[model samples]
Target: MRLTRRGLLIGAGAGGGLLLAFRLVPRHYAGALVAGEGERIFDSFIRLARNGDVSIAVPFCEMGQGVTTLAAQIVAVEMGADWKRVGVEPAPVSPVYGDAVLAARWAPLWMPLAPSLADSPEGTLARLHAEREPFQITAEGTALAAFEAPLREAAAAVRAVLSMAAADQWGVGWETLEARDHAIFNGRQRLGFARLTQMAARFDPPDPPVLRPEPAREKPGSFPDGARPAYPRLDLPAKVDGSFVFAGDVRLPDMVFAAIAHGPQGASVLSSYDKAAAADVKGLVGVVHARRWLAAAGTTWHAADKALKAMDPRFKAAGRIADSVALETRIDTGLRKGAGQRVAAEGDPDALLAKPSLSARYDVEPALHAPLETATCTARLEEGQLEIWLATQAPDLARRAAARAAGVRLRDTVVYPLHAGGSFDARLDVRVASQAAAIAKTLNRPVQLMWSRWQESLAGYPRTPVSAQLSAAMSPDKQRLLGWRTRMALPASAIEWGTRLLDETSAQAAQDAAHGKADPLACEGALPLYAIPEKAVDHVPLDLPLPTARMRGGALGYTAFMVESFVDECAHFAGAEPLSFRVAMLSGQPRLVACLQGVARLAMWGGGADASGQGIACQRMDLAAPEGLRSGFIAVVATARQEEGAIRVDRLSAYADIGRIVNVELARQQIEGGLLFGLAQAIGGSTAYAAGLPQSARLSQLGLPLLAHCPKVDVAFADSGEQPFDPGELGMVATAPAIANALFSATGVRLRRLPLLSEGF
Candidate 1:
């Protein structure tokens, strides 16, 4: 039976209570790993071979984030395996690898009625949904928080059993044995894991497992300049040598290349195509027509693309066509006249905001994901079974979509997850899987479907466009912020994306369900982290004609830009320094305060005075973990100036407090990469729509920063004893506002919109 929210509610009512319904829910366990000869499987996360090699199963997609290496390092550290012998494999879909943390955090998307009941990883509903749907999604930087403890426990169990095996032969107690460097040691005697794997499989691990004193942690300052990581990325050598495989790199026997053309966003029905023109194209195999798209299969991708172009498929509009002017008008109307639903509130913001001391308005256009690799999927259908290969954040959901599209049972569908060139949350969309499945089923052979650049732009959902008005009520002196309120206008984007992800519904259906609803996810991070007495956030949902999806920074991307830029303006209005103003308000958050101070010193902050071109911004992100809330703090000091009629960022210095450090090198890489991504978003990454199609169809048209345009970036992490917080998004959320504030200092003109200077200066 399919699990729907309505079905769940009905079951709960019929069973008298949610507790009884949960008890009656069927539980699923991870299937056994396919082990090779002389290999022993330890739970769902670890496999030990007779050659002393330890293979860690990484459930997260490796979209150039080093997740595979990070996961393998965690297991290697806990199991005391040799780093050189450690390897990683893409984990199979299973309930044991489900991401309960992400499920809990996104509880509102699935269980909108009572999300609080499942607001934690350990919550009954969260666990049940995660396991049943097998929600092993890889977005939101929740990898470590969800899988760290489980990976450690699995490794530790393997270590314990191996030691027990060695102890049996050494005639010593297992407690006296130490496992390290791929061997079990008892004082001077040593036994390699290869010699004991068969015997260890016979012994049962200690109840609860004997975990190490500290779960995998990297020493601060371990990898300084010119120093190599203790556990280097295992995928690096292969990636560098061109042996690493991505979704687009997959090749199968008797595979035909297919190129697809999707209808424009609003006009999604195929009306006509020139079959004779396509038939004349060399190497053209056949054409497959779907409800919304047309595909041409050929021996080579180039030929298929040529055939698709020759066919000249046309689509008729079935709904209101999306255009830039209409989108802006809708947002403006919502912010100006529509009734807003209060999404977040504290104290009495209405009373204070009645007479605001300062106010600002901001706008953000739809930003594209623009990953290096476009959507590519290879599928084969044979004898009622369908197998697909793709790079997806949500593998199980993609498999289900493929199964349904191919008219096969979900159990008969097999998914082989591949590395992504880059996703930026784009892989969360599983439409390519269904498209490939349909094409392969029609061709009755293996087919590799690739979306062209234009098709990707036409079909891909960009980040939601938003308009917001922020107001601040200050003290009598206008130095201290007293109350804050933000009214944002946007579509219920999160719910729309969730419906497509969870329910596998059409975009229009999802938009229909989410129309005119208050979306807390859309307004996330609008509430300031500062010590304000009264604060509130309101969401005015616009019924937009276009669909939207999640990007790298999520809502925090725009919310931070608005909040930090507004704070900078307030600081200036009060004749205060930008850094000092933020520090004064951040009394409760010592970590963020430290980061602000540290970044200021790193950038040699000049108080963001006129023509100084130095500006400061900070942000805090709190994520729920097993051990309470995990918070990540970041501060960026940007030095930017107007050069040759364009914005040129000179340097960006950042300080981050991401709690405990797992892998210092990888952490630093993530921060640096996020900064570059933010720089891209600040400069371009966005596009305008005309006649239901994006004006910018190619990467070059998006105005992404070139290598020469990239500024010098310096990153530092605070030495905190807090739980590990993923550092993937901190720099991204903080960079844009910093740059915007710096530009204001440089040119003495405040740019309020994202992709700063979208409105001509």
Candidate 2:
């Protein structure tokens, strides 16, 4: 990957004498899929890969977050590359490559997720006024929230660079040329991005590339007011045709297949006994019962399965379980112990909650990613080194973690990340990969280990089991929010799974810290989507063993279900329609207000649906990020009831605010798919965890939204959309809450809990 000259100076390595030749710079990350990128270097290569084809590397594991497609779209848009040529691949997550690229890409308009550096009011003032924002500074908004001025400025900067280069080429004044509808023009003729790029490359790089002025505005691919033309996604065909190979799909000479299990889910295996079964099975290459061992076999995937079954390794749980109740008690105890930094202290929530106020508690059961292909890794031990293949969101994390497990040099290991069928945050390069590497090393042969469906479910990392408790104080008018308090139980680690809640030390501490407050996950967009000047938001994060990995919609979806539903409760209490109440609350958020208005107009808010029409919920969470994120959206689903009084979604219509939409078909699919996903979440994707074990294992028990249940889901685009807000994620956050809110009107019971069963609603 060659680096542009200007990029070279900015990415100078350790020493000055070392020019840090871009090729040697290792901008490309290496994985079992693509290994070589050392984090930061590989990211820069995305811009350089534009020649007739688009090529951009991603760092976030595709744990089904749709970051891969989103990242490629952002890069392709900026590079002036055609949708057909874009290449989306995963990058290594070098310790150096924190969440910066993602933040820079998706949330350019907003600030990064930084901690508060200011301990006092004075420091806060200085940070707010700093030229470059102070580090470790927590602001008074969303965890990753900020103004859109910077991203707009970046778009303007890019347009300016193109225009300046065009001016030099055409011998015209810089202001004489304006970038419009993806082309630059003066009067006579127009030059598209292809022409300007060629001219710009020929000219000496602007010591500081002529930047777009602050007042500069460039609508990359114009779409405003709920309309847009779809762009193309990077090489999605690679996966469709099997032209691309995944870790599980890897094949090699003398390579054996394997089906293995990790120490059950989160618990470690204290010991195992498989000697008898191993001896009885044919072609059983002995058994390795070490902390991590790979068992091998001869022919087919069936052979791998049979060998594992024959080995019959038995284990004992070495780790403890943490659940909701246990987590709460610990939090109460931890708060008394007084640990950790106080995240927020807002207008008297204590006094507010103590006063006459409505209070509600939300409980979320554990959810697994349940990807089509569970985390699979195949590895072959070569002469003194190892070669590996797998689908990973972060190959670098795989390399390092694998290197540690295999006891080899990082350079000797190669990882490949294949197209993901599904990843819901649990598949971020971790133990799954480590096991693959360890097995390859122990067997000293090319071995592939695919988690069995049972293993995949039982051992896979899961979405945290969260319990959100909220208390709200309303003014005499019942319009303005006087105050709010929230409490949340956090998963043990961002990646580690929490079997139960409040059963661990850290989980308890988190619960206690947030024992009473306005929880962000439960109260995010729901709070000020309208406007409340005197309201305060706070959270209690209970650290339990729940997996803190990425879900389709993490904080947004989980909390929105609670917050949005509560907003409706207040609206209904006021004897005003939900949409009208929200419109009244709109003060600081005009886009949000406008978005709500737009969705309501289409959904026919305030109208009755005898299963005919339903109100809508809207949020612009992705707007806080850079341009072209496929997340900012407005949803309005018309729900109708059958003779049985069951809600069947008739048709779902949405106006997405994704700045610049790429692959309109894919974007639509994301929304439609998200609708199905959310529908599934509302009606299907729920699981009950009792005594630390999941009750549902198969699709039959899990209740997925099949064709019979899902109705026509129609999604529309806002033509002026210049950003690429993520659709996969946005499809979910507002769904359950919206559906529940709609159901509340159709059926008098405000279903406070999820999995609206026959008895509950």
Candidate 3:
């Protein structure tokens, strides 16, 4: 029974009876944990040592998101382990650690046809596909939703076995014993884990172990203002002391450093280079050339970079070059002339919006990820086996790509995951792994590839540029919205990204397959938060020369700006206060209403009148979780003023309701970091393309906000007691609109484009 993608698709289209029957069969995990001497393994998540030390395996990548600490905290609380003895390590790639939640959320990418059949983690199709592919990629904030339950269950099973071992000694029922403080007790009898681990390994854990009444949760006021975290981040000490290991920090015996140069946007063929110039540099090993890139290796990275620069490699453009003017023209033409594909709708929006009362256009330029660390990977191919050290969000995909590049079997590839300085969803791309593997195979030695800042700008994909027109039909009084429509023009960014990620296709091939296709992921958050009777969201796909990928905030990063800014304009047109106008329409969402009112009170409740220099905006995100849809709500109030011919944001006040708080300090830090990241996007992080290259190649040229220029940020969370939601992207989605609206109040001018000053305000 050979299975292929084409056969599966054909079966799915032919009534899907075969696939349905296959899904009905129960599936089991077949992977086992590798244990060391004097250590006992519990499933695939926990390893207990004779020294009373516990090492928990985290499947998600830790790119400064506090995921390692959060995951360990759950296990610690459930198993009653001492926090001081708990540590975290990266989990091995196995079926047991597959992320079913992420697979279900991304069903459209893998199972494009009839995605509804596998749109849940529990669905057999979703679980089986995830396990088969071992899809444990760490994007979309699904870490907690996917792993929290299993981690708790694993810890509970360990506790049950240890309790049983202790009960055997005390001659009592295991249920009468409790496991806490690294010890199992029955009445006055106590046995430490160091003594019970060997005995516990001999007993079988009970089926369906009993879980605690409640999972780990921090109280609302657990950590007050200027207080230390209850459980400090386990990685903080090493990171602060310059001992944390990133991809670039990995070293191997007799390793050579390599630097690469990629062709321009429209170029693929490497035409020529000055080999003589590189030969003059001392310690230069050799030069390797690929179809689209050239690499030079040396004893030191500096020598390799210097030799590469001296060689002056050049490439020939194979097709049309990417230009900013041409990209903008395509967007404008598509918005006006291209036919739209309806992706979401509630009622007859076309009829209700025949005569729109108000319509406004918004535009956003392509933005960069600009993490502190560039793309870095180390690879060594020896004796038909490939070993790679990389910091990637998708480990299995990267290993597969690297194996193919080295011309080895997938089973022979070993990937060692490392920490990233910062990703912002940039590590999802695995091109560097393949490039490193190729270079190492060519050189027949260990090689570490590092992309220079200039090369990163020339090769990295930016967030898609978008142009949209929002139309609204209001009542006779012009105070209530009756109909709403959003017509957005952009490339099929989501499809392009998915093809490259899931299919391992080139950027050009992905773009070709995605051209003219309507992407629902690209139109996410276009739905209005307010209760409008009629609404429609339309997508106008455009074929562009430049490629695009996902960024930190995803689609809502831009859609929120358009919707919230337009809502502010409508409020002014109705001659009503901004906060009050929003509250009136938010009758159905009590959570959002509470956030808005709370933010108003936090920021002194000053109406956004003329010269008030105050602006308000709100956003709602519902992420797919195992139990159901988990939601996160946020509202931002910004104060801005013009000082010395510069826009100065004085303060930003935000209030959020993200259900139960797990780690209070970590949640607060995530919100603050998101606010700063959004501020950077609002000010800069964009570039203009000319002659198939970006005009801004250096970080200094991107006009990022300085620390001294950063605004005062205040964040507060609500005690909603709902399911916990990740607060990473909530603060970012609303920051741009709040600042733009603030600038509008400060000066009697509205900036309809991102970066506020792109049109030279």
Candidate 4:
């Protein structure tokens, strides 16, 4: 009884209630499930029911990006349904809705030097699905590109079914009946969708669905004919009204809150706890123990927290914890271990670099997600079924991990993904869900497990630190770049977690690491965009003691910081204007050049430079178009000024070409928000560790950029017409590099490290 567009023909239940479910391909293993050629059955993505309500079972988690609204608008536009009567729920875990296209795209990006499977996107998707496993978690900005076509098709198929029904009732041609505003209108009369559903359910849909013609082109910001209305984000009203239910807001009958504590790093045993100390605490239920962690559930959060502090547990293998300096040393040592894998190489860089060449080394400290809401999950065992709820990036992964931890059958567990406070990549891991489920199963009651900011600070896997050594050789005349060589060290991080805990965020990285390869995502944008005769990039995967995962732009932000800064240095050495120098080298990549040119125009780059120096940087961001194509571009220019011996960003101008724009306003906001996030990181911040715990756990210690510190951000989108490309995560790609270049322009100091400080000035 899988939900499908065809299933809608089966009709609504008695009493005028309509429900249609979309099913993904069913599989015991992700890759094992494949669609046979000419197969009619498709994976379910959304369900529409009577009561003028449309329910979107979102395959991707919404981390405040307005995906729910955007996706729902697609269904509403295709179905001709009213936008005011729509709601969203997390899609159930299934292989049918797996991110095959996203996975396929990641494969080539991580192995850029490898031969592509085939020319066409469909061929590549088929090859990848047949060969490698498809990841199900959401990350890498694949939501819009992946679901748009399938969702539109699904909605269209349903619309066609209703049209056929309307045509039959009115004795008119099917083509003559049109769906609009939840009603079908023929030349003579109109039928509300509710009345037509009863008749539509009786007839079988055509074997091959007839889809509507694609909409005509319009301006970049315009929602072309038949495009989804850019209604204020569907999730925003509830959030603003305080009626939104985040993971922390979920409650159940007899629900008890729990606080968790860790023994040590890599600890997998709950030896024993101080039961006596916790027993005296009022409202304290008791301590629940799992293999690697312990939790205290109580009548109230305060009680649980108070009891948790009173207990102590031991572990078998205490993991190593290092201070910030020690952690840096560990990463540096691992980087020096080997040359690692060559991600991109062209010509002989070693030979060209034998001549005197400009060299620089760049390093970035580990940064935290540090969202307002900590990791939270609730689990309950009811009628032999395990129900889990949480605000997680990967619902399917969490479901699977919960089943394993709680000794429950995979099919018996249902996961409900709620709204997240924030989850750059911190929520990608499912250990929290596993912990909650274990406690719930042990107690035989509903358990709400939440981590304190301190606990999250210590345990949450943050962005891995990265260091790179880059050298560039110029021609004898110094007019052209001759060679480029970059050797970088980055931990495999979340990718090394193996198959038992596979997630979309690091699935490609894990696959690359398994075959002695560097995760392209970890080294993306490392190669120079400039037209250099000889170029090569090699990476060393550092297995750091701290758990590492992607944070925002991942490698793009860090790599661009180094590569673009180096471009500026080369420009300075060659006695050429920075913008002109980059423009000269970018002729090979016209699209990139165009984006850079747009940013230059917006920021007024090289316009006699302000007393407050301005810097420009550009890079290709990772965005998967709704058409399953992986192509997007972004460029940024940041201005900095000295204020009482401190460096302040005076202004930020970002230009992007995301193929096409979805919601013009949303795209701008995403770019602006990403810029601010990047600025927060660049302006002196680090998540340090000491004595086996996080030193900077609280907000104050993290040194997040205050609202007052943020500068005016101006954003511009290239007039790339109606074909929308990837939109989010593009703004931050070049932010740090541009700021660093601006710093270099302001002060003659070559700052090659992150946490950009004014000490150099």
Candidate 5:
């Protein structure tokens, strides 16, 4: 498959790591809750200061997930300046700067992971941040505030300080001076900020600077303000030209190459003794095995491999699994101890599932990030401190891990991110970085460790393999929903033991009892989404040992398939058109209903099912709790039957109501990319794993929708003109399900899985 989808404006931390341990960290984590230790360092973070330059002092690094772009977009939108007028760079950690408050926002909804913000009430932006609740921002969120807040604050402060200084010079009240664009005007003269910044910077620390807030908060116009231009991304020029700097692209003085050459046949670590064999490679540095990892050192990659081959005879495979089904059982059991975990219970789910119910099971296999680039992190000790140079997704996480590895304080480790080849959900994955940092520190030198393709594939964790089960009860009317019970599997990396939605202690028991049995992801859509009064959703999750992480796409894809397929099942029994039935059930769902109706209008839903193929799907992503950024999104796809048994996507359309849009074009692009990937997945999946490894190890084998496969896709945005919405991630939600629905018309198969492939009808 030739895929056409792209993600956020990350410097994607690293995508190639499964092959070479190149990185692309996930800037966006769907289900993982955010947690940070220690006291709040910064009362309020002012990471980016405007002086025609934008600097983001992030704890998280970009392995290649486009976080820099998101951060830049946020700051730029906050400042209400032209994207070109501002610049972006990472903020290094300091005693008074890192903000854990954002993690509250980061802690999650399902879009974030569920947090304890149930008691938190929404308030003004100031009060929201003043308290330690996570600060929320979408690319659009930052842009909206850019015009509304900070620029206004900065401007007023500048004006007030200039007015005070001018008053001292002129022997008048400070109010006597008025302000305009970048200028302080008094009855006698006017001074520009360029001229005043110098004077203001020199003011004594004791000088009380009375900053003024904009008088009319509801109004948008600032002094000499006009609307920001909505156009193509300013950074697109560099992206188009390949001049963009990514983490993998970063280079520092005296960087050495190292590969963590360890892992069993299918990704488990084995024993090895190749010290003598690797001794003769030119430019070859010595090899070391720490934590069972085989490290080959050299100036060039070729020399390292020679050394690695020399050491191969002494290797032994350990903890290897021969089959997917057997590993699947162990993983599912290990991931499901979360049932004992506490989550908000709207009703008694067990008592509800106690009645007779229809049920299904699902199992999602381990998938790789399979990015074009592999994992690569460069670490060096400089002046008694360690510095990291690479593309990392979660720079903050990497920084913390690096600090731990180096036995240094958080402030001592500096991680610089470069652009990334691509990122899925693992950009925030810090294991690869942590391993490299640990190795480098053990050697106490500057080393650029890059994972070989096999190491990248097997050594790193796979998208957490998931298992799910659902059972639901039908009411007498056959239309009303009675209850729902679901069981899922999770990996250790995703949830800490005893946390809500996570239970580590019972995972072993869960998997030990699950081998040779059905799994849940395979039946994700087992429950209907329609409103079922008194309905309760219960999940029994499994925990696994082979190290799993969220393959968000897999969860999403599987969930959609099960739900949609089940909806068809429900519809078939009800003897109603699926579209009409869905619409009827969603009567009061305004945003969703509107989006659904809009997509139908765009896709031209029909009189006959087989004549014109159509599919519909929607996603609702919660932004922040107090902010209340809940919004609905929907899309519909129109597919034409293959004329002569060839794969062809005739037309695709979508309807999205993300509340408000930041950059319309970027939003559209995001949605379009989502649709392409969604449709592709509905076809089968971007990559396939076997014996715990990705078959599509390189881009060549990876299936993607290229230009030839591009459909005539169009999108319509419904503003409802709402506030506090996350347009960034929601852009891609509607495309796949809608396309799958459309394809159902073409081929009577309700796609129950992803990557609707060529061979499959």
Candidate 6:
């Protein structure tokens, strides 16, 4: 199926693998939860073995987001399985194991009534119909929202069978049997899962199984009324003890290590290599030429690296591949030159903006993922079937890329997902995985390819650079927002471009790249939630050669920086306090208003009499399906001061309402991480482009936020009593803008550019 914007969004929603194995016991005794062999195999998510082991296979790739735990929690809660006995594994690349994150992405953002878990049957069916095809991918924080219902239904179906088996065994009505905590109880007697598993396995599944509603949280947090799931992180212990297997640590018998010589230009074609200079290197196996890059195989990684460095390859059209000036010109032109595609518009914003208005332009430099682990993959082509092991967010994409590279059938390729060191969205690109497969296929031996720090930095896709302009006019009295307009110009994601460029014809790719979907992922947060009588939002997609891809929060992180910071500027122009101005504008969005108020309270906004300054910003992140399935809200109050010519963030407090949080600590951590990431972007996180190449390829040059640079963050979760939403990147949305606004409040400086300090503090 073609990956249109709709498809990309659907697949981009949160999507994982389990390391545990399922064992079997030879037994067959005869129920609704028990499934005959034929029918039991239908559900790819939950597998109940005769040994009473319940295993859940998640199609989402886990990169430290606790997806495995989430999947297990859903299944255990629904199936009544013991959390300790439950096993988690990565499901194979199959539509049967497709993710619901896509279904959520398929939902548009502008729909009047948001999609919810409580949608009527007709609404739910309409959503299902809009989803052209069910595919698997993990992104855009769709994991829990997408999989919760389906997984619960699957588990509940199994539980019903177990209940039926117990009723038959005890000669009692099924209604008398209660399945809880991995046991079936009938007043005075109980049957353990092991004994019941054998009987259930032989029973036929009910044609239409009765499913239960979501289970109440095992225990209450500070809010006793809040329902939350309690789960021990299944992937943590192994990681802490060093037993977790990341792709970097994987090994295979007689495996040959390969090092890549990346083209400085974005996916530059391989021209020539210095084979003679590397011929004398010890343990040097062979140098393989692959599309867009070169790989050197050796007995050891060091040997391969040494040989690769000695043989400096050159690309045909290498010099001045990506020029920062040229890119900026393109983005600027796109933003102002054309009739921009209107993402959202209401009333008469242009006419209102004709009056005296507050205007600001925010430019975000290219940012890199700079994940600690780097790009690593191990692949083998044998018996006309290709097998690959890697840490990737998109396993199915990797499988397809490998199949195409190896000239094999897609069904013949298998992708084994391992723990990722870190992947904001870099691993979603399959260039490295495809290259590794091609090299392995050529050598007829298992090949493990690991990009060196510099190569990975140069070859991996970075976040797209963008330029956004915000213009707004207040009422004649200067007490209310009258009109607002935001225009963001950004290049289409490299994934979309690559989808069209490689293998597929341009005509076919153009068809797949059609628009008319919800705002592109590259401009996620350009539209604001603040109530404005007249408003306009436009997202201009630039056609550029730069390799663009998702980085951390996709477009939301940067766009939020633009909108919120500009809003602060507008607040300043209106002669109102930042918090008060925002609160006043949020007339209809009570959830957003509450989030803003909550953060202000947490940060002690306007309470301290001291001269210390704080800046506040608020946003509502929409993960709801096209009609409004699920949603999230966030606001941040940042406290910072200039010290010795550097911006020092002293403290940060964030308030969030992402429905019902599953894990408070994990939720807090995600927020903290996102805030720090945003702060880093504001302070120094950027990729420098020069002479067609990214100059900042090393960690030191990338200027990642150090621990000492992090501010003391105070997080508060709003008591919305709603369904859980993805909290993965919510904390990042408001960070940059809050810091920028806070910096302005502290020094009366108007900064409108990212790597925020680059424009001068």
* Candidate 6 lDDT for residue 175: 59
Where does candidate 3 stray beyond 4 Å?
1-32
Candidate 5: minimum summed lDDT over ten consecutive residues — where? 1-10
Question: Using lDDT as the measure, which candidate wins?
Answer: 1
| Candidate 6 CA-lDDT value | 0.71
Relative to the unseen true structure, what is the Cα RMSD of model 1? 5.6
After superposing all C-alphas onto the true structure, candidate 3 shows an RMSD in angstroms of 5.8
Ranking 5 against 6 by TM-score, winner = 6
Compose the digit string of candidate 4's lDDT tens values, residues 1-761. Answer: 23334343322222212233222233232211122221112235445554435566677888887777777777777778877776776765655456655555554443345526532335545334522333566777877666777677667777777788888878888776777788888865888776665455555555455556652122544643234645668887788999999998998999999998875433234677787888899999868876667789999988999988888665554444445677688667766776578878878698888764698788888777888889999999877799999988777778878888788898798888887887877787788988898888888889999999888887776677788888899888888898998889876543453332453233334434543456655677888867888898888876565656677786776788889888888888888788878878887677778888898888888731434478888887544343545567888889986677667898999888876565666677688888988887787546666655676779888867788888888887777753566566778778888888887777666788877762344
Model 5: runs farther than 4 Å from truth? 1-84, 94-102, 105-191, 201-232, 265-267, 313-322, 328-363, 442-444, 467-493, 496-529, 543-545, 552-557, 638-648, 684-693, 755-761
* lDDT per residue (tens digit) for residues 1-761 in model 2: 13233332222232211112222233322211221222112223343222323345454445434445655554444433355655665543332223322323222113214323321222322223221221111111111222222222223344555677788878887657766555678897677765564444333333333433322122423533245445533345665776755557678888777777444333445365555665555656534445633354545657666767766665555454534455455545543342333233444556666764687766555566677777778777777686667776545556666777788887787676665666654465356667777777777777777777766766655555555556677888876666665554443232122111111222224333433432333334433344544444444444454334446676665777777777777777667777767767776655566666667666655553334347466665643232222246465555644337456766665666654554556566667676677766766555544344456756576766668877766566665444345566777777777777777666666676665552343
In every candidate, how many clashes are there? 0, 106, 0, 10, 125, 28
lDDT of 6 at 229: 30
Residue 286 accuracy (lDDT) in model 2: 37
lDDT of each: 0.87, 0.52, 0.86, 0.71, 0.50, 0.71
Candidate 3 global lDDT: 0.86
Please give the RMSD to the true structure for each candidate, in Å. 5.6, 7.9, 5.8, 5.3, 10.4, 7.3
| Structural similarity to truth (TM-score) of each candidate | 0.96, 0.74, 0.96, 0.88, 0.74, 0.87
Give a tens-digit lDDT track for model 6, residues 1-761: 11111111111112222111111122111110223342232244666655677778777888887878877887887777788889788877654444444544533321214544423222443234222122466777877766676677567667776887898989887756778878889987999877776566445455444566555343124633223436768888898999999897878988999998876644357888898999999999988986567788999999999998889888765333676878888888887884577766767688877754677788998888888888899998999999999988777777887888888998798889876877876776666678889989888889999988887777766677888888888878888888888888776553353343232323224324533222455566676777788887887777655666567777777888888888887777877777778888787788888888888778888831124468888778766542255678888888888888788999989888888766665676688778887788888767766655788889898767678877887877876567787788888878988888888878877788888777766
Error of 1 at 236 (Å): 0.6
Give per-residue lDDT, candidate 4, residue 257. Answer: 96
What value does the lDDT take at residue 386 in candidate 2?
69
